[model samples]
Target chain A: MEPVSEVSGRAIPFGRKNIDTDIIIPAHWLKTISREGLGRGAFQALREDPANIFDQEEFKGAPILIAGDNFGCGSSREHAAWALLDMGIKAVIAPSFSDIFSGNAFKNGILTVVLPQEQVDRLLEVARTDPINIDLTTQTVTTPFQDRFAFEIDPFRKHCLLNGLDEVGLTLSRDEAIAGYETMQAAQMPWFAKGTGLAA
Target chain B: MASRPRTLYEKIWDAHVVEDRDDGTSILYIDRHLVHEVTSPQAFEALRLSGRKVRRPELTLAVPDHNLPTTPRLDSAGHRLPIADPESAQQLAALERNAPEFGIRYISATDAQQGIVHVVGPEQAFSLPGATIVCGDSHTACHGGIGALAFGIGTSEVEHVLATQTLLLKQSKTMEIVVDGDLTPGVTPKDLILHIIGVIGTAGGTGHVIEYRGKVFEEMSIEGRLTVCNMSIEGGARAGLIAPDEKTFAYLKGRPYAPKGSDWDEALAWWKTLHSDKGATFDKSVRINAADIQPTVTWGTSPEDVVPIGGVVPAPESFSDPSKQDAARASLDYMGLEPGQKLAEVEVQNIFIGSCTNSRIEDLRAAAAVLKGRKKANNVKWAIVVPGSGLVKRQAEEEGLDKIFIEAGLEWREPGCSACLGMNPDKVPAGERCVSTSNRNFVGRQGPGSRTHLVSPAMAAAAAVTGHLTDVRELME
Candidate 1:
């Protein structure tokens, strides 16, 4: 994971509410065994029209995306996050995000900023003509016009994005704790692992 | 001091905590991990790159469902047929190789137990009460029906579980969605859940763990409860749970993975304590009258775009929110529907009665009952019934449900999530409408440019016979 601190770039204004994972990357693109090269398939359905915002020259390789409320509202596909990352999206600003999508984005080093609807609307308006800035350190999103909005994020997520912490390695460091729990679990709840055995 | 009365979610979360970090995140142990082909190949590749082995292989089960075709797998001469899609074939081949290489249990696509991960988990008793189950598929919440703490994770988290069997997590707020009155006739669990999502909106349950309670759920069958819990994700919740009871016990008893004899008795004692205590409070609560729910179906792309079968298409202007109004208009355009049109008058070209949401044996029986002695309407171009698993298909055949479906002019196909996501070749053609028993009705969910209307198996069968979104009650009449 690449460490992310401050992202300043042109932001794509895609103000569509309930923009689900299926819309981000349709199910047809999920067949590949490899995760690379998903940017070509990102938002494929909406990009069918040449005038779609994602493919526009002005927003090409935009690092920030300003979207409407309840973005990424369906599906737990990390491919949605990978697709956005592949397309050079470092941060997404929305009024709200689905729980699973927020987690996925965080795991992949993409920042999910949740502002109020009015703040998001203002950003969407400003994003059309100017660059936007996201400062994870200050926990704020700023526009070129001096518009600023503070957003809340989980503190643990903030640390991870800032440090590019590998979660599996972090959890692996707590192996002793996990083994201790297992030992106690075996004593108190033996039946829970009763049928767990080597694969036949 | 007396201990605080914890809700079911809190109890499960507390029990599963391996360590509580200073950052307010807990390392929660996962008891069971279900794997599928599409979301897992990348995770496996990462493990191989990192030289990491699966920490607890016995706790993981892998199967191929998303990209596997539901059509017959063997040729007439008994040789296996090759998957037509190259990308899909590569993914399936990866899972078949990865699972065994990691020492995990692998159910082959040709095996009797192979099915949608959500369906296979509960059927084999691999998902048990008070356990934490994680899967790469969103509908993994289906196992919550039997009182397990189950939710979906992304590929990164899948790798986390495979390496350590723990997830770094914050506790979700608890919400109780209680339904009291008896559901009206022909209003199945699917209808109830669709109506619930409609009331709550798609984001209503965000950041909350919902526990279904009251008279309605208590009397519901295990399969019915599973169907309701299955759509928790569509309603914006990570998981949905129902307290374990006699029906839950009965559903798991003597299954292949369930505990035996002394273990069963001991497990039952602990399971009986899985429910919330009297006076236990939740962060939020909703009361719904079961009778208010009708045979519901989605009228637009989003799951929250649902309307009762008796209702008419709603105008975009009818929505209170401006953004919703815009979305409604776009949905109407994509769905090729007009405002004020009768929902039942809209014809469908395809009818799909299978998914992790509604392909269990009970679902098959419900559809078969509706299709018995009735021919599919001539206008319906393709009607198919794909069972959830080979075992489910065998069970349906033993019950003569397959014959009933075949005689009704619907193709009886093999299993593996056919047409649910249109990843396989069983897609509803572009620009056509399908009444699907699957969970999502998102844009092009069945296929690019395809329109989907989510409904129950009975309602899907009703639409198949009538060639329109008719209420299942009318067919029963």
Candidate 2:
């Protein structure tokens, strides 16, 4: 996960709420066991529209996506995040996101920035004209029009993103504590040390 | 601080606390780890890179479902699409490679018990009452029907569950959605859930764990309760749960993964206590009338945009919220239906009678009873039934349900998440409409430009014969 100090990219805005994973990547695409070539099937239906943001020349390779409230709802398909990442979406600015999708995005190194509806509306407007800036160090989203908004992130996620820490990183961060607990539990609960894998 | 007796949520919350931060969040230990093909690959790779052993591998279980193809086929290159897509194959392969390394049980596509994780978990009784269950799949909430505080987690959480058997969670408030009275004939569990989602709206239950309590839910079979809890996400609830009762205990008994002999007696004693107290306080309460709920169907984009089978589409002007009005208008236009058009009058080109939500044995039997001796409508382009699990497929075939589907001109296929996402080879083509027994009906959810009307299995069978969105109650009469 990249600590996005600042990002300036064209925005592909979707003005719909509760845009689910099914729409992001259809279940048919899930048939392929590989993550490779998934970007081709990303937004399969939306790409059918001649004026779709993905197909439009102006938004091609844009690193930012402005979505409405409750974005990335539905099945916890990591492919949805993978597809967006594959599409070069570095940051997703939305009013809100599904908790699972947001976590998936955060783990995959995509910045999911939550702003108030008003800020999202303003950003959506400015995005149509020029690029937008998101500074992770300052936790502020800025546009050329002087529109700036601050957002809050879970400190652990912030730390992880800043250090590019996956699950292993988070666990290793607490290795000493875990080892200590294991040693303590071994004395208190000897069954835990049996290595027989019995249910507690 | 005031003294208060701990609720089940609090008890579980306190029991699993590993790290408490100043920010009012505590890391809770994960008790059980359930994994699938789609999300385990990267986690395994991370473990490999960091020289980490699978911690407490005994608690972990793995299965492959999402990427497996219902139809066996060979690729153009003649390598054979083992599970349909190369990506799904890679995911399954990665899981296969990692399971042995980690000492976890792996149920492959060829495994007799290979099916959706949610279905497989409950069928095997691996998800017990009062346990915390985490899976890579969102429908993990289905296990909550067993009174477990189950919810979906990400790959990172999957890793967390594997490494530490714990998760960091902000506890959710509890809400009781009580549906009174018995369901009328032809009204199935799917109808009850659709009615709940329709009444509560999609966002009504956001940030809460819903306890579905009522005569209707109590009377429902274990499989039926599973169906209701399965779509909790559709209603925006973090999870839906039902207290364990005799029905739950009976269902869990004799399952392959369930406790055996003397252990079963002890387990039952513990399970019987997994219920909310008589005076249990909830953050919110909603009472619904079961009699008022009809065989409902979704007409618009979201699952909440539903009306009775005989009802008409709501006019955009009827919505006071401008954005909602715009959404309703867009949905109607995209669906090619006019305001006030009878929902039943809407034609359906396809009928899909399977999904994780309604593909169980009971669902198949219900649809089969409706489709018995009936041919699908000549214009109905596609009508298929995909069982939820290989077990269900086998059970249905043993009962000759597959023959009924085939004789009815509906294709009977293997089990997986088939038409539920336009995944696999089953999909409603562009510009087509379908009556699906699946959960969501988001625009293009079934296929590109393919409109979906969510209904019960029997209802889908009825529509398959009529080639329009019709109620099965009339046929039952």
Number of the top candidate by DockQ? 1
Q: What are the TM-scores, per candidate, against the unseen true structure?
A: 0.99, 0.90
- What is candidate 2's TM-score against the reference? 0.90
Runs in model 1 deviating more than 4 A are: A198-200
Over B1-477, each residue of candidate 2 has an lDDT whose tens digit, in order, gives: 944554455544554566776655666655567888777786677677767777778667788776566775345675544554565566678889999998887777776787878888787677776667788777787887877777887766676677766666667888889999989898888999998988787766777888899888888998898899888888777678888899888887777666666666766776676666666788979999899888989889899898989899999999887878888988898888899899888888898888778888999999999999999998898888888888988999999999999999998876777788765557788778989999889888777788889999999999998989898998884
For all the candidates, what are their Cα RMSDs to the real structure?
1.1, 3.8
Report the C-alpha displacement of residue B39, candidate 1, in angstroms. 0.6
Cα misplacement distance, residue B90 of candidate 2 (Å): 4.0
Q: Which residue pairs come into collision in candidate 1?
A: none
lDDT, model 2, position B118: 82
lDDT of 2 by residue, A48-150 (tens): 8788878888888899999987788888778888888888888899988887788789878889998998888888888887999988878998888787799
Candidate 2 off by > 4 Å: A31-40, A54-58, A173-200, B1-8, B72-88
> Which 10-residue window of candidate 1 chain A scores lowest in summed lDDT?
A191-200
Give TM-score values for chain A, per-prediction. Answer: 0.96, 0.87
Best by lDDT: 1
TM-score of 1: 0.99
Each predicted complex: what DockQ?
0.71, 0.35
